[model samples]
Target chain A: SAVISQKPSRDICQRGTSLTIQCQVDSQVTMMFWYRQQPGQSLTLIATANQGSEATYESGFVIDKFPISRPNLTFSTLTVSNMSPEDSSIYLCSVDTPPAGVYNEQFFGPGTRLTVL
Target chain B: GIQVEQSPPDLILQEGANSTLRCNFSDSVNNLQWFHQNPWGQLINLFYIPSGTKQNGRLSATTVATERYSLLYISSSQTTDSGVYFCAPTPKAAGNKLTFGGGTRVLVKP
Candidate 1:
């Protein structure tokens, strides 16, 4: 099992303010993913951050809204820029164990719950 | 993009009862995983069964890659099992990215 932690278990911010969520892992991982969960909704993939490369974002999400920084294997940060009340959601960082066979066990951080007032 | 659908969006179970959750995928997948989100919002990995069957404690999962569906069995369910259960499937041609299903919300009353 991988130990993952995210800063700011939760926060309440005014609209238009930006917030950066930090994710730290106990060991080196090649792929780190960011996900979002709106109130009463399932998880949605935001982007994939890999060391030494630009992040790849999924549809309906853009870098201008969520910029990711993967400085190294064990650290990554996600910035929710120009926040709005609609951006209020739980942001989670996930990493999968090195591919062993066809199974890559994925683990999630505690998640940063943000509420824009 | 692959589509994932889980049955019984909401489930209510009594303690010590047995329940099964199902996940259906629209495309062939190279990987499938199950996750549990607790009331505190902590997501925990329950199984990484891409194919075949695997069991741990009172929980077990089986993924039939050929059939494009999976099943999760909870035997003797406990109150702790009350939460949201999610299934993520990765398309065969896609990288390690996971597309999560809407999830099944389970409520276990003791």
Candidate 2:
């Protein structure tokens, strides 16, 4: 299990503003991901943060709207650019545990709840 | 991309009762995990069973990988168990990327 934490636990922002959420992990991991959960909905994968390279986004998400940065193995950031009412959701960061003869699971961080008005 | 489905979208149980949650996936997966999301929206990992059976305390999980389905059993439920339960399965080629199912919301009454 990994201890992951996110900054700005909860925040309220006006439309057209951007909020950058930071994710820090206690251990070094090779794979980090960002997820979004809309109110009363299932989780959606936003992107996969690649170390020293651009993040790989999912089908519905683009880098321009949700840029990601992974400076090292234990830290990453996801910025929700140009906030809107529809962009309000909980953002989560997760890291993959090592698979050395054990079941590899992704441990999640305490998500950041963002509300845009 | 694999699709995951969970049954009994909502469940109401009295304290001390037992309940079972089911998860069915479209394809064979290398990773299957169960998570409990509390009212405060914190995700707690319950099990990481890709196959066979495993138990912890009053909770147990069984994953029939060949059948592409898994079951989670919670016995002697308590008020603290009231929350949303989610199942995530990752394909063999997808590394650690998880595809989550529509969660089952459980409400335990005192």
Q: Ten consecutive residues with minimal summed lDDT in candidate 2 chain A?
A: A97-106
lDDT of 2 by residue, B1-110 (tens): 89899988999999999999999999979879999999988899999999999999999999999999999999999999999999999988776788999999999999
Q: List the residue pairs that clash in candidate 1.
A: none
Give candidate 2's iRMS in Å, 1 decimal.
2.0
Model 1 lDDT at residue A56: 93
For candidate 1, the per-residue lDDT at A50 reads: 70
Q: Best by lDDT, which number? A: 2
lDDT, candidate 1, B1-110, per-residue tens: 88899998999999999999999999988789999999999998999888999999999999999999999999999998999999999888777788899999999999
| Model 2 alpha-carbon drift over 4 Å, by segment | A99-103
Top DockQ hit: 1
Ten residues in a row with the worst lDDT in model 1 chain A?
Answer: A96-105
Query: What TM-score against the true fold does each predicted structure earn?
Result: 0.97, 0.97
